[model samples]
Target: MDLFTLTVVNAFIALVATGVLAMQGQADRQFRYQRYFLLAGGCMLLNAGISAIHFSGILLPYWLIPALTNSLSVGASLALAAGIHRHLQKPGKRFGLLLVFILLFVLHLTEFARSDINHRFLISIPVVLLLNLWCISMLWQHRKTELGKVYLAFIATFAFNILQFVFRTTFMVLEQHQIIQTSIAPVVHNVGFFALTAFAILVFCCIILLSHSQQRQMLQQLSERDALTGLLNRRTLELRLNAEFSRCQRNNSTLCLLLLDADYFKQINDKLGHATGDLAVQHIAKIADQQLRDYDLLFRYGGEEFLLCLPDTDLPAALQIAERLRLAINSAPLFTPQPYFLTVSIGVASSKDSQSWQTLLQQADQALYLAKHQGRNQVQSYQPTAAVSR
Candidate 1:
């Protein structure tokens, strides 16, 4: 509508964004990026507050208003870039960012900047455009990641702000050079402020969507993974096992199952504590993970027990892999309050020998029982007649 009304709307939106980000920071203390976003919102609020005060016909020094508002606007943009950097797990250049703000503030105080509003826009808008471009480049670098698509809205909002700044700058220059009517300048300026208000709303919505998506992914991971060892849990294993079974059946390829159990895990828990026992299991899981291929899937089948799904592997290769895992766990030492040696008994079963994934798992379990029966810390292959030790 009008400049004063638009300024009031911008201030109200900034206030709401600041409050929401503050609550978000409190809700998730571990999300460090939220703090930076909160700072950005605060800067926006301060910038809008100054604009509102200036437009209200308050008697104030002429240069103070534009200089303070422009610097705070740039500070808000820099804060947004810093938040994005932190969200991506990158270190922020705090000193460099502070120095940029100082430079902008000092430049705003110059006679050249104070003499003409167009000069001030030329000085400040390019810096805002560059920060927006920097943010776009960083987000583009991670465009293929799991949350890449989620960043699209964020990127588009910044891109739109950049275009609005360019458009405002062009009209400001035209008004300064008498190329456009002076009346047209205020309308263009009002449109720019409106665009900024829309940008703030869009950015806030994108932040909410991004946070919701992240939390949902984290919850899904927790549901599908073992809380102790961070390995896939049995619940997820069933789905993956069935999928692999169907794929192998259609392609006539082999799928192997290796059932691994920690030897004397209860003894470690009894001698030390349950915490030490957890450490022992984690040690075994880590060693086994290091010994397996990238495509191999490891699952926590039970307490002190893990199951591995090896796709396109025959009995012989599966046996070799099982033996390698066994040796790796046997040699690795678990360092806890009391150091102890960890070992695992692995059983190998191939899809070719069984009719279904369940039967294959049963055969591997039987082979694992035979390995423990014979002695711990060994690998056994399931045969129709009997289990052969390897």
Candidate 2:
């Protein structure tokens, strides 16, 4: 299509990207990277609009026309670079943004505003190249994530953008010096126009795809984690337990499971409030986590109940660890509005020859029931009454 049509299309695409990113940022408030992406999209839309206006036959005011339009181009590039930096949780360099804008304004005032419209691209080329290169570096630094290939693709796209500007700048210089007198400049111009349009679309698509991937990761975490305590929820606990059990069987190694319940959790909720009860639950979970080994897996089995798996531990050692956990939670003071001590009753179950996950969980539950029945705030070990078939 013609340049005018292509300009309008770019503007439309940018505006749509802005709206979509804004909505995504609104929906996922914690992922602050989305806000940066939304800002980048807005700048892109503004840049495209400025480009379209500049292409029209109407004359704009001296200081407000090409200067602002080119500034927006710089803004679009800088915003994407900033968004990538934020996405990686890097420390901010707010002054760098101000410095860039100041430099761009200086160029606009002296060189760009006074020169022919054709020269503005020459001024913009280096700025765009540096910003795109910065973005590529950020993406490359973080290329080892779960979406490593996606990050690499983004880097490759930005690298191509950098090359486009590099070649464009070189051609502009060659033409200015009358290096090769021919109509080749127009051909390069047309190619550059299409390349810029395609690059804009690709950049927005990458941003959206990256946002979707991050959202999926966040949702997966939410599904598997307890919202209050941040421990693995029951939904994930079974899968983890099964995997650990199979691993232990194949390795012929010992493994232990501990089922822990906050003592008198319902009474705490009834006496205090659900909020305080939540605090109590969190306190117990924290204490339990502190007492357990780093490799051990902890899960919120149910309300006020946590499950822990310990690999390479025999029944005696598991009981000792369980007792230590029980003591730690019982001794720790939960300084709430109504300050009180928290306690957990933990039931220990160790792996046996040809034992299944179901049997281990059942044994732990029964042991926990016995611990609570005998008295709360203690640890009990599961002792099978009989040896049956697997």
Task: Name the top TM-score candidate.
Answer: 1
For each candidate, give its TM-score against the true structure.
0.89, 0.79
Clash count, predicted structure 1: 0
* CA deviation > 4 Å runs, candidate 2: 1-5, 22-31, 59-66, 93-96, 111-127, 141-153, 177-181, 248-254, 266-275, 289-295, 311-324, 352-354, 366-390
What is the TM-score (0 to 1) of candidate 1? 0.89
For candidate 2, the per-residue lDDT at 40 reads 70
Q: Write the per-residue lDDT of candidate 2 for residues 1-390, one digit (tens) a residue.
A: 556667788899888888888887888788776766677778778877867776775566655567776777788787778778888888877458757876886788775456775567667667888888888877888899887777987898898788887888778777887897658776787788778778887887887788788878888999999999999999997788899999999999988989999888898899888989888888888888888888899999888888999987888999998988887776778887656988788888888833798888988887888788878788988767732233
Q: Model 2 lDDT vs. the true structure? A: 0.81
For residue 139, what is the lDDT in candidate 2? 83
Using lDDT as the measure, the top candidate is 1
lDDT of 1 by residue, 1-390 (tens): 877788999999999999998998888887888887888899899989888888888865755588978999999998888888889887646558878988999999999998888788878899999999998988988888788887887899899999988888888777778898897777787889989999889888888788878888889999999988899998998899999999999999999999999988888889888988888888887887888899899998998999999999999999989987887776777877555778788888899989999999999998898888888789988868984554
Clash number by candidate, in order: 0, 0
